[model samples]
Target: MTLAKAAAEVRERAWVPYSRFKVGAAIRAASGKVYAGCNVENVAYPEGTCAEAGAIAAMCAGGDYKIAEVYVIADSPEPVPCCGGCRQKIAEFAGPDVRVTMATTDGKEKTVTVAELLPGVFSAAHMDRA
Candidate 1:
């Protein structure tokens, strides 16, 4: 299945109660495996897990460290972009050229690279700066 379709399918399982906003994410690892996850919210709010984070976790669990592409789907008036933390998470597992696709349930969508979403992202190289 397409990444967008995978995300949309997983969205049905999101555990959002407070906001009632469900989100889903799918990531294609460099190994060509597709992992999917749905937002899992907790009553404590701050402890909630974003779909992107969950997907990344699954990828790591499956022994893949590089993300080649990602797709996220949400029910909204417009394509919903990843949260700031998720953008950084994506950057951590993906290269600057990795494509990130944001989409609404009704098919509206936008695609951009990880670099475009988080320009000049913090990397290990920054720690080497003198």
Candidate 2:
């Protein structure tokens, strides 16, 4: 399935009883496989898992460490951007030039590269002793 279709399809399965807000994410791994995930909420509020993180986990479990592209969908008036944490997680697996597409259920969409999404992102490069 296409990234958008996979995200939209999985969105219906979000476990968001607390907030009633749902989100879905799909990632195209460097292996050329598509992995989809839906938000999973917890009673502890912020303990809930974002869809992007779930999708990234699935990609890793599927043995793909690199992300080629990403798509996230939500039921909002406008395309919803990834949460701060998800942006960093995505940057860890995707190149600075990788495209991330955000979309609303109503058809509105926004696309930005990883660098644009998280300018001055912190990476392993910062850990180098040299």
Query: lDDT winner among the candidates?
Result: 2
TM-score of 1: 0.97
lDDT of 2 by residue, 1-130 (tens): 8999999999999999988999999999988999999999999878989999999999999999999999999999999999999999999999999999999999999999999999999999999996
lDDT of the structure predicted as candidate 2: 0.97
What lDDT does the true structure give each of the candidates? Answer: 0.94, 0.97
Model 1 regions more than 4 Å off: none
lDDT of 1 by residue, 1-130 (tens): 7898889999999999889999999999999999999999999869999999999999999999999999999999998989999999999999999999999999899999999999989888888958
**Lowest summed-lDDT stretch of 10 residues in model 2?**
42-51
Could you give me the TM-score of model 2 versus the true structure? 0.98
